[model samples]
Target chain A: MKPARAAWLFLAPALLVLGVFFLLPVLGALGLSFTDYDLYALADLHRLRFVALGNYWALLHRPAFWAALGHTFYFVAVGVPLSLAASLGAALLLASPLARCRAFFRTALFAPVVTTAVAMAVVWRYLFNTQYGWANHVLGAIGIHPVDWLGDPHWAMPTIILFAVWKNFGYNMIILLAGLQAIPRELYEAARLDGASAWRQFRHISLPLLGPTLLMVTILTVSGYFQLFAEPYVMTEGGPLESTTSVLYLMYEDGFKWWNLGTAAAEAFLLFLVMFAATLALLRWPRRSGA
Target chain B: MMPRLARALVNGLLLGGALVALFPLAWMLAVSCMPPGTANTLPPPLWPAHPTLDNYRQLFAHAGMWRYLGNSFLISGAITLLSLTCNLLAGYAFAKLRFAGRERLFRSLLGLLVVPAQVAMLPLFLLFKYTGLVDSYAGVVLPGAATVLGIFLVRQYAQGLPDALLEAARIDGASELRIFTTIVLPLLRPVIATLAILTFLAAWNDFMWPLIELTGQDHYTLPLGLAAMAREHTAGTESLMAGSVLTVLPVLLLFLSMQKYYLEGLLLGGVKG
Candidate 1:
């Protein structure tokens, strides 16, 4: 057989799966977004009516949709920076020559990333419990009030953000550690010869060199943080006056729970556009600054 | 003297961070073993004074956790094996084969990466429902069988294989299948290990898709089952902790045993892709 034919044969199963399951559904979702598809329509095809852009328009007027978007943006805005900082701090510590038990620390830091999120979120619910949680216990020890971490609307998103950071920072830490290791030791030595303090060396040499990795990690984290669902689903169930309801959680509820497939598909698309713009803006910022 | 002080500060910070990171998991285990209701006491105990297996026994016996555990194992295990095979073949072909539209197709796959998986989910569910796959193992397994990231990782690793190896095999009149199975596969073992671990951990820990797809109680994976249990058993702290342990322990142990491959795959997918 010809090599091309053989290649097609090799690609057949994977391509089939991707086309049928992933690619087709994506196009189908786009098409579905233009119509009024719901549980009734699902049961009877004739009930489906083409409402070109109606779902998107309805979402624009819906308060819950806007609130969900705001919550999702809050998560991304707050969670991304906290996650990156924690990751970078841990990575810096692990990378330091002064640090001992490097492997142990690295493994311990990364352990949370591999655990089941739903299960860990359950653990966090208990940890942040108002009356009986360790969080309140620690706060009381510090002469602080025992705040309702997951129950109060004002604090629920922040609590979830804290959980998100703890659960995810290790992933970026490993990547950034790899980036840190790749920088030449000579650069740091040269800076020291110039009497540069450690802070100056990091600012001038380390940060500049780690720019691309930092930006890439930022983009990945931003996008990942935007899809905040399982955390809120398991921890708060979008509770405390819906303070923790993320955009994806909203989409889940609208599409699955309420059987509003068209509206959910529209929400998904609107989110895609937002993510695309955010990533594009992120990519362009570094270039615009002549980095 | 300054260096010594700095070293002390750095080590102290590292120790503190490790404690923060590992504390929740450790607490989960401690609370799981505690006699029921003991964890709700004042000054939450770090260790169970009177440890027992009652929670675990109750979890398996009363809560139907054993069935969910079985479901999780079956779903994650099947997804791992099937996805590994799909990714390996496609990755190798993209890396080595002389094919029409190869680069274009690969670029298209990369483009698909930016569209979040959630977008496809709504219609995907409808499609599955139409096909009678909803609330079934196939519904969960099929969508996750081959991911763009998995294929990208394999292709990156496969690109490093020398052309001379494939050329020599071809010169010997080895069929493409023969060459792939005999020559390419053995060389791809490192990546295969990496992909297997990554895929298994992902499938085992996955909650969103399973939650949406598996509608029936009888078909729920561990995460789905545990989430449902949390809703109903909100006050059952010991039992919930035990259930969390059961849900997280398998993947945690798998990751610990294979940290090398898992980390390598993380860097490979993130840095390269």
Candidate 2:
């Protein structure tokens, strides 16, 4: 058989799956976003009608969309930095010469990443309960007043962010550990020989070399934080006045719960645009600063 | 060359971090073994007063967790086996084969990575509904069988295969399929294991797509069933914790056993790819 034909044969199955399931539906979403495809239309195709930008217009005017967007941004802005710091700190300790039982610590740290998010979220909800939670119990032992971790509107998002960080930081820790391990030990040796302190060596040698990996992890984490759904869905049910209602959660309610396909498709596209632009900006920011 | 005091400080901090990471999981297990209402007290118990298998028994008996567990295994196992095959072929083809428009096609697929899976989900649900695949395992499993990330991961590993090996196979009068099966598959074992574990875990833990696609209670996966159990005000905290434990343990054990390849795949997919 011809090499090209054989190659195509190898590619055909996956390509068909992607084309039919992924590519076709993405195009269908674009079409759906321009129309009024609600429960009525879902019941019968005859009720479908094109509304051309009307869904986007309505979303722009809807306060819930804006609120959900704000909540999502809040999650990304706060969660990304916190998660990155936790991951970096853990990686640094593991990479340190002073640390013992490195393998055990690494596995223990990474164990959370492998657990189901919904399951962990449920566990966390119990752990953070205002009355019976261990979090408040520890605080009480320290002579601090109990704070409503999940019951308060203002605290719900923050608690979920904490859970998100604890659940996710180890994943990035593994990647960042790889990045740290890749840097030449000779570079650190030379720096120490030059009488550079640990902080100075890290700021100079480790930071610069780990830049690309850090940027990639940041982009991935930011996009991931933006799609915050399951945590809030399980922990708070997007409640205490919907403080934890993420954009994806809103999209789920609109598309699945209410059968508002047009609005949900528009919500999804808007989110994709935002995520794309955010990652693009992250990719370009360092280049501009260096230049 | 560091002082002993500073070394102790660093190790102590690491110990603290590990505790923070493992505490909730530990608490989940402990609470799952406790009797009902034991956890709803003024101070939560760190260990079960009397460890019992009653919660697990209740989950299997009353909550129908057995069904969900079977469902999860069936769906995740099918997805892992199917997607591994799809990704292996496509990734190998892209790496070693001489094909038309290979680079362009691969680039476009990478570009599609930026679009969130949620964008396609709305329409995909409609597609599944119209095609009568909704509430079926196929609806949940098929769409996940050919992810771009999986292909990218396999392709990255496959690119390291020596071209001379493939050329020699061809010159020896071996068909492409025969060469792939005999020579390539053996070499690709590491990557195949990595991709299989990743796909299985993702499918097992997946919630959103299953929630949307599988509307019936009978078709529910573990995460979906656990979510429903948590939402209902009637379910006991002990049973819920047991459900969470049951849902998480298999993948956790899988990861612990195969962490070397899993971590290798992470760096390969995240840092390099």
* lDDT digits (tens) for residues B73-176 of candidate 1: 99999999999989999999999998879999999998988999999999999988888999999999999888888889989999999999999989999999
Count of backbone clashes, every candidate in sequence: 0, 0
lDDT of 2 by residue, A1-291 (tens): 878999999999899999999999999999999999999998999999999999999999999999999999999999999999999999999999899999999999999999999999999988888888899999999999988999999999999999999999999999999889989899999999999998999899988998888898999999999999999999988888989999999999999989999999999999998998999899998899892
What TM value does model 2 have? 0.99
What does the lDDT read for residue A60 in candidate 2?
Answer: 98
> For each candidate, what's the DockQ?
0.87, 0.87
Q: Which stretches of candidate 1 lie over 4 Å from their true place?
A: none
Lowest-scoring 10 consecutive residues by lDDT in candidate 1 chain A?
A: A1-10
Question: What lDDT is obtained when candidate 2 is compared to the true structure?
Answer: 0.93
TM-score of each: 0.99, 0.99
**Most accurate candidate by DockQ:** 1
Give residue A85's lDDT in candidate 1 (0 to 100). 97
